[model samples]
Target: MEFRYLGNSGLKISEIIYGNWLTHGSQVENDTATECVHAALDAGITTFDTADAYANTVAEQVLGDALKNQRRASLEIFTKVYWPTGPKGHNDVGLSRKHILESIDGSLQRLGTDYVDLYQAHRYDHETPLEETMQAFADVVRSGKALYIGVSEWTADQLRAGHALAKELNVQLISNQPQYSMLWRVIEKQVVPTSGELGISQIVWSPVAQGVLTGKYRPGQQAPEGSRAADTKGGADAIRGFLRDEVLTAVQGLQPIADELGITMAQLAVAWVLQNQNVSGAIVGASRPEQVRSNAAAAGIRLSGDIMGRIDEAVGDVAQTDPALTASPARRPA
Candidate 1:
């Protein structure tokens, strides 16, 4: 597996980070989840990313059990806060000092680790003061609960302000996790430029556009049985936007490109995301062990300039590139 430093930090992570967003503790059985984790380790993936809100915290428990016997020092485990993990009390959410302080301990307990390598804010809390949020993160680092800080799905302006505060507090703000794929190019315009300037690398999720780029959902066809689009508990709503005939047909056009390179459409999609210099890792989720093995092959493949141009020509018109689409909702459930 190829590795890269997350942002300007000296810490290195695998190019393909194994993530359990929708499969662990919800869609898949515990044994299946454990098998997938083992497969990732066998494929030389050392980085694992999960969030407190995933599967109502059961994802972390399953992931923790999967990694319990492994040498802790050799792995880079990341988790996030800022979502309602429990009862809907005011203190149960947001990036307030109270929530941050409480959330880290719960996360540590669920993860079966004393500290996470990277602790991220799942989203920018519009209701909380930025200072309070930054100070809470700084406190998390000082307390040795997290080695570094990151944010997910934050706008460029939010990132800049948070980064400034992190610098002032002497905290290492190293990465940003966002939804990035051939179909979603919102980050390229502003977030990437701001993050590049601030020395923050992107650990992008949905590099295959929530399985849409795999070309499994053909145009004008009902989604295959048990696929993401058919599994309501596993990202069905999120994948709905990309289920249009035009998008599916456009994705189909990339099959020949993948055939030419002797790669699966999923591998082509993942390799496409890693081509960006600012992307530290692409997060991939799986329900089966073989899926992990197949996607890991994209770690070292590099696309030529002509292939990239061909990819752009194939899906550019259907891609979502509006910077305005990058903003988070003012009020999430948390």
Candidate 2:
């Protein structure tokens, strides 16, 4: 698999990163997770992304176990902080210094690794001072707990603030993980450009718009029995409302291009995202080994300029309907 430098950082991540969001701790068992990881590694996927909050912190433990017995030196591990991982208490959540410190130790224990290649803040924390958050991350990096630091779902203004704070404090902010996809171009206006200017790479999540671009959830039909949309709470309702028949009809128009390329619609959708230069890696969340194989194969399917244009026009500046939304391009900070 071809590797790309995450923005300007010297560290290189696989073009397709295996993300364990919903599948690792829910749909897939320990053995299945191990099988998927092995399948991904065979396909040249070296990077793995997970969060402490996903599956009540079980995703991290499951992912850690999947690779704990393997050669840890051969893998690039990435995990996120923020979100509540403790019993009902406000102090257990947010990006406060206390949570940051405690969270890393827990993550390290669960990941079965001394250090994560990249540690990311899952979201912004208005309650904590930017300086405090940056300082805590700097300490983690200095203490060798994490190799690099990143932020996710944070606005450009917050990104700029954190970047400037890190600069003043002599800490490096390596990347920003956001929901960037063909259907969700919000990052284009500010987050992408801002992070680019700051020399921060983007490890984009949900590059496929949660399977909408793959044309899996048809407009009128019930979601396929075992799809993510069906498993996720309110997922079917959300998709049915946002992904209308017009969108499906438009999606159908792109099938011919995918056919000509000898790739599935999911591959075409993933390939379309990696076509952009700023994207460091596309996080592919797969429940089954076959899905992982399909996504990994997408790394080689390059869409020509004409097909790219067709994809753009087909989707037509659609807004993301995912509940955990990211910054919107139209409302991006100036």
Candidate 3:
């Protein structure tokens, strides 16, 4: 698998990172989740990303169980905070000093690792002081609970302020995880430029727009049984925004490009995100082992300029590129 340094740090991560966001504990069975994780490992993936808020923290437990036997030194495991995890208590979320300190221990225990390679703030905590948050992260690094720090879905201004605080506190804020794909380009204008200047790389999620770019959801037909849109749990809600007929039809246009490259539409979608130099990895989650293996093939893919233009044209104006579209909760999620 191809690897790239996260941000300007010397630590390298696989181009394709296995993530268990929607599938680990909610959508897929435990045994199937383990199989998918194993498939990722077999495909040469060394990076894994999860969030403690996923499935109310059960995702972390399942992911930990899946990776329990692997050599810890060889893998880059990442998890995040900032979302209400347990009982939705006020103290159960946010980036306050108390929460950060307590959350790390719970995360470490659930992950079955003494330290995570990277620990991220799942969102910008508008209710807390930046100084308090960064200092807590710095302490996490000093305590050897996390080797580096990251943030997810944070805007450019948030990243800049956080990066400055991290520098002052002597912590490495190396990565930003965002939803980036051929159809979701919100990070391109503001986030990417600011991150480029700050030396922070993006480990993007939903590279296939939560399977919308896989060409599986057609324009007129019902969402196929067992598809993400068909699943009423969280997937349906998460993927609802991109379920328009125009978007689906636009996605259908990209199949010919995938056919030309002899790659699946999913692989093409993942590769499209990696084409950006600032993207260190594309996080792929799977409900099945074959999905993991197939998507991992996106690693090291090089799409030509002509193909890129074709993809842009194929998707047309259906892609969302508004910088203002990037956001986090105004208050901690309840």
Candidate 4:
């Protein structure tokens, strides 16, 4: 595994960040979760990404237990806020100042750590003012509960405005988390460019398009049992648009590319996402330790320029029509 800077924040995070969204409290047992976390650390992945809402907040406990005996200073822990973590209630979610402050304390307790390396607002909360969210996150940083701040699934305009607000308040928003993969190229339009301009690196989630680019589901076939496609929680709908025969066929065409490159389709897909200069890291979720090991190897597989061009052509035209997107100039190493 290789490491890259988390945006321009002077923090070097592993290229393959182990995401605890699906495995810890959802599929893997405690013993298995420990095994997977150990495997990631052995493979040089120092970053672990999770969220408060992942599996009713049990994921944090599982991860915390796994790393209980390890040196905390050596690992980079990242978790998100802004999702409902309880029975339906009026103030159960969103980026309100009250929620942000309360959520971090709960996360810290569950993770058994004094602070997380990075804490992100899980998504944009239109109901909450951006200034309030920024100020609350700044307070998190100042209080030493979170070292840095980021936002996930936000529009380019939101990122611009949020960063500006944080700057005014003397707090730096370090990164942006968005879905960017071979199957999802929407970020190429504005988010990537805007982030590049602001020096906020992208820690991309679902870099393989929720396993569609893994070539596991072929055209006109039933999804294998226990696969993400078979899952109902935020997984079923993820691949719904790409469930068509045409999309599956396109995915199948990548087999030769993977074979020629001496890598799995998943590895090829992940490496392709990391090929973009704007991408700081790719968060990979796995149900097993071997899967984590396999996915992390993607960091070493460099896609050739010609193969990248071929991939772009194979995926067909994808329009990025987000109004918040802006054009970006070439990126220079910081």
Give the per-residue lDDT digits (tens) of candidate 2, residues 1-334.
8898876678898999999877787777878888898889888999999999887789999999888776877789999988888573667787789889999999999999999999899888776777899999999999999888899988878888988888887767878888777777777777777888888888888877778778777767876887766765434543453467776667777788788888888888888878877788899987678889989998856778998888777776454544335632332111
Q: lDDT (0-100) at residue 42 of candidate 4?
A: 90
In model 1, which runs have C-alpha deviations exceeding 4 angstroms? 332-334
Query: Order the candidates by TM-score, highest first — what do you get?
Result: 3, 1, 4, 2
Q: How much is 264 displaced in model 2, in angstroms?
A: 0.9
- Give a tens-digit lDDT track for model 3, residues 1-334: 9999999899999999999999988999999999999999999999999998999999999999999989999999999999888887879999999999999999999999999999999999999999999999999999999999999999999999999999988789999999999989999999999999999999999999999999999988999999999998899999999999999999999999999999999999999999999999999999999999999999989999999999999999999999988898898877
Clashing pairs in 3: none
Measured with C-alpha atoms, the lDDT of residue 26 in candidate 1 is 89
- Give the better candidate number (2 or 3) by TM-score: 3
Model 1 gets an lDDT of: 0.94
Distance from true location, Cα of 94 in model 3, Å: 0.7
What TM-score does model 4 achieve against the real structure? 0.93
Candidate 1's residue-wise lDDT over 1-334, tens digit each? 9999999899999999999999998889999999999999999999999998999889999999999989999999999998888775878878889988998999999989999999999998988999999999999999999999999999999999999999999999999999999999999999999999999999999999989999999998998998999998857987999999999999999999999999999999999999999999999999899999999989999999999999999996999998888876697564
Candidate 4: Cα lDDT at 291: 90
By TM-score, the better pick of 2 and 4 is 4
Q: Tell me, what's the RMSD of every candidate?
A: 0.8, 3.8, 0.6, 5.3
**Can you give the TM-score per candidate against the true fold?**
0.99, 0.92, 0.99, 0.93
Per-residue error at 1 for model 2, in Å?
0.7
